[model samples]
Target: MLKKIYPLVFFISLYSYAQTSVNFTDNFSGIESVLYNPANIADSFYKVDINILSSSTTTGNTYSTVKPLTILKDNKFGLNDLDVFKKISSLDATIDTIFKISKLKDLDSYVSKKEFSEDSNFYGNSTILGPSFLWTVNNYNTVGFTTAIRFNGYAYNFNSELYNQFTEKTYLNNPKKLLDNNFGNLTGYGQAFAWYEVGFTYAGVPIHTPTEFFKVGVSLKFLRGIKTYSFLLNDFTSNFSLNEDVPEDSVLDFNGSVSVSSSDTGANYGQGLDIGIVYEKRNKTLPINNIDKHGNIYYSKAPYSFKISASITDIGFISFNNIKTQTNNVDLNLANSNFAISDYLSIGSNKNQKETYLLPTTGHLNFDYNLNNHWYLNTNLDVYLFSKDRINAMKTVSNISFTPRYESQHISAFLPLSINNFGIYKAGFGIKTGLFYAGSSSVLTNLTNLSKEGDFFIGLKIPIYNSKVVSEYKKGIRKYSLLKIIENIDEEENTDSEL
Candidate 1:
């Protein structure tokens, strides 16, 4: 039943990283912050930001901690030519001897083998940002555009008994008493999809006062779905008998109903929306020159001591117009004999159908506190808006993270500590220097092979800071802010003493 599942797993292994960025709270992040909260674009440090290219991937499962990057690294650096299976097969001589009797490979000994726990689920996603840019229009308004390709896949509610049937040969290959005589009431769903989006964002400061500021932003996107594969097992029951002498000769009774769909033709279209709002506690010590909302001016520095933000993203769905779909209902008795499960399952008609699938929408809340001019602390919570049982919707994991960071005009570094819905804790670090950035959410875990998930991402971009700040300072329209003035005063005093 899961013969085609291997490819999905392999595909997921190739792109395993995490979703959110630790530097989203940085004032200089610019357009990259649009993915988390568009409101952040307002009052940002950059007058113009252009993303050349960026890619990230997320990995999670109740299975192994083998990251795709780790695998690639091993293959590139390790000297042994033996494949993964060969290495595992050579682990235990006794187990290999026992498996020799059954004429089957021992997969249970694989280091990254899947485990059957009370909660069995897997989720993976990848994103590639392609040629995007942001521009500050005026003092109060900012606009940006983005293009990205995304992929998501998930499996939920997988049962252990059914999982064993696929992994253990004794369950079906050898002569043995039926484990349950009749195993029934099994349900699960798995889905994978890829799509691309082009989006436009607008952000503006709605209310700016002496001690308070409010900003709002929205992004509207057009989505083109490339392909999709989905399967749902509503109910299943099976009873079987195995011939002791001939494992290949088995009689089985099957009763189940499943819905399966795969894309076949042209691209499908959809629309998506992301909305966010931010409120700031203005720093009274910072020097500010109030200007009309229509003025072409920008802040030279971050002006808030504390800020809180909320956002909801990916609120949309895509329709697969050209698809091959089948909903099979099987109930066979002694009438089912030597036919393999796959051969018998194809006894139904497949029709071309249209199916609309929802995106992995999520909500985020963030609180950021500035410790000083160059240091800050941020806390964030992310939650999925849709239920896991909604098989038509892509799935995303929820997590809460706290990060401490150092930020400056040209460089920033952050350390994030987070825990996901699965109770997996992670510590990660990220750095942005000039126009290049790279990080991993599960860096510690990936290094030790102790985590069930891992992540890695890198990006390059060009950022142009506001020239108006320099012009204003030179023309006497502006002076150094409070902190800068104090630093200059201290420097001059030290210079006089040296003289």
Candidate 2:
């Protein structure tokens, strides 16, 4: 039975990635910002933004301080190659030697040496943003289309004994006491979900005044579920009666209840929605709107002194059909039966089931303060709204983040710091030059072994910026009427017309 769950644990480790990127808040992020807050597209710098491709991944753990990637790196060199190891330094060689010794003699070598809580937890997510675009429709409206493949999974409150048993397998060699009357009582739950989604977004400025500005945005998404798997352990008990004369005749009795469900490889459809609103107090009044000769509207810049925004995202579920569900409820003795414990549990029963798994619905709040035209400070808070008690549901780790950035028309740099609910701190940095950007939430820690989490994100895009910034600013004014722009939509115009 434990063997059946090994793949799920391994999958969690390999697919672990940060939930969101810090660069998503950049002013020039364009379509990428829509994922964090759709309202971010309002008053964007781009006339049109086309995202070619983007990907982000992360690695983290609560019980282990040793970095997984570093261990893999050290494992590449053989200890017998003393010359290669000595080339680094005496300290480096000593550290590598200790790690190799642990790996050779201990099955649980990777487990942390520090004391851990009785119940442990881990969360992971991955995203690949596909081709997407954002288009400024007019002075007050912006629209966008996005497509992505995403994965979310989590394990919560796993007891230390259960975690050790699953992560390590050391059978009873001498068989003195295989089980006791007070043994085999544990409970934990975990789930993993993957999907592909296409989304449409609309953002509009409903109120634009001299000091106060307000914008609202909404996204409607269609989802196709790729895979769904979950397991729950309610109660398990085992007792063994040893046969000293003939060790093979030992008997083990078991009585427990559990449920395992998974969907086959097939299409499952669903829908999702995200809505957000932003309000800003302009540092310099928003520049009056201008229309190109081709009727393309321009705002020139985001002139906010300070702004606040809130959003709700992933509010939907997917219904997976042709699911395989196995529920256990039995009392059996291994010696009395011809089959092993795992074979008995595996052959119990199977029924076709249909289940609906909810997306990792979350809420976000953001506050941004501008120091000047080129520098800004931002803070964000993310929270999960769904119930964690449900074993089949998906969820993201809630976190609070602060980022400071230096941004210009052509280049930008930012540093982001975030802390999860479990108090794990992560520091990261990013750089954006023209249409390309890359960053990581665990960059600082990845260089050291002090932290257990890491992340990396990169993207390429084609951005058509506002042609120019005017010498003088004006508010609540437009050079062309909205009605006149309709006629120009079909006409060819200069893409490089000055703002």
lDDT values for all models: 0.72, 0.69
Residue lDDT tens for model 1, 1-499 = 5423432343344333335333344777788889989888986667789999988777777654444444454343232445533643452434334234323333323235456553467777788889999998877889999999988888777665555554565656643644335555567788899999999999999887656888999999999999998877777777766665765565667778888788987869989999999998865444454543566433334346788999999999999888887788777654334555565454454666778988889999999997765678999999999987776788999999899999766788888888898887888888887699988767876555566776667899998877665354333222334566778899999999999
Which runs in model 1 stand beyond 4 Å of their true positions? 1-25, 67-70, 76-114, 165-174, 177-186, 241-252, 289-303, 335-346, 470-499
Candidate 2: worst 10 consecutive residues by lDDT?
471-480
Q: What is residue 205's positional error in candidate 1, in angstroms?
A: 0.9
Q: Return the lDDT, model 2, position 426.
A: 84
Pairs that collide in candidate 2 are 16-58, 17-58
> What's model 2's lDDT at 15?
29
Looking at candidate 2, what is the lDDT of residue 380? 92
Candidate 1, RMSD to the unseen true structure = 7.6
